[model samples]
Target: MPPLSEILKTTTTPNGTPWLTSARVGDGYLLRYAGMADFILNGAGSQLTCWRVEPGVSADTIRHLVLDQALPMVLNRRGREALHATAIVTPKGACAFSGPAGSGKSTLPASFFLAGFGALGDDCLPLVEQNGSIQVLPGYPGMRLGRDALEALSAASGVTAPVADYTSKRRALALPSAKNFPREPVLLSRIYRVVRPKEGEP
Candidate 1:
């Protein structure tokens, strides 16, 4: 079988950039970009999957893919359980982070991870209803953090890794575990909205 990178490079979309060209590995899809990669797994039959890529891809790019492409695909393909939220989860429901671009949504989640909280999602997290309760899909193994955000987190968490190895326009970073790198999808839970206050507005 061709390596996932080779598979992606071999395929192309109408615009020339590889859109949905990926290889199926186990229960997940390994997506390879020119300089980065991520995995998408089937979350409860929902086409939307938790995304984790090598540190470098822009968070804005991730947003565009998830919101513009992936989310819609899930809704159309798996309407039974559609989620619209950016969140992380604990044993008690889900904590969502909602905000616009560059609003620290990704940073907050990374902080949570360094603080020992499990990652539910970073850029695009799925929300679902289970047993009349809202649930969020535990996101992929890691997230992309901004430079300043990484520095702050390092100070707080007292855990530092080479940003050079995990830095990008979005400053990507992996969660604090190797097992969290799932080769499959996950279920959904709650949603959180992360945002930055307006200048001088509180």
Candidate 2:
């Protein structure tokens, strides 16, 4: 991996604190998440390398950042559309639920998994135009959820580990534990925008 040099882009948290930075390094790009991890993606988006910056950073956290965050940046640069959504493979095809943070994007798919429908992706749903239609690509087969949601979903038996040491969010396996997780692309049939119920509106 090439060494990171001058910063090229910066992404911040909801409260405005810098969260991730992208910098140029020879023919590759370095994506740095302060105190968490650094990822180097080659210019062609074919190769990737990463390491944790802080001690005690779990491999789960690094893997999460790489797939859910860094890879999306690379895909976007390659002209693929990545959405903040969760997709499930239903009888009709793939149904995607998309919205801002705190929406039911992740939870919705967990529920679908319980109903025997396979989850296609987690929070980062990547779409590809294929054969004159849109298709949903499979993401990592791990879903992160709060303790309460995890408990309700599967009695928390599928919980593997916390997403990060600093947070209580845990990853649950979506395959055998949750029933199914499709590995192949599914045709996109519908998209629903998930939203929290307004006051007194059910």
Candidate maximizing lDDT: 2
Mark the 10 consecutive residues where model 2 has the least summed lDDT.
174-183
Tens digits of per-residue lDDT for model 2, 1-202: 5566778988888889788899988888888898888888888888878844677777877878877888788888778998888877878898988888777688777777766777776888889989999999888767778888877777387546768765688777744424455767899999999889888998
Model 1 C-alpha lDDT per residue in residues 53-100, reported as the tens digit of each score: 656665656654554345544553465344434455455645667677
> Which clashing pairs does model 2 show?
none
What local distance difference test score does each model get? Answer: 0.52, 0.79
lDDT of model 1, residue 98: 67
TM-score: model 2 vs. ground truth: 0.87
The residue-level lDDT of candidate 1 at 125 comes to: 54
Least accurate 10 contiguous residues by lDDT in model 1: 158-167
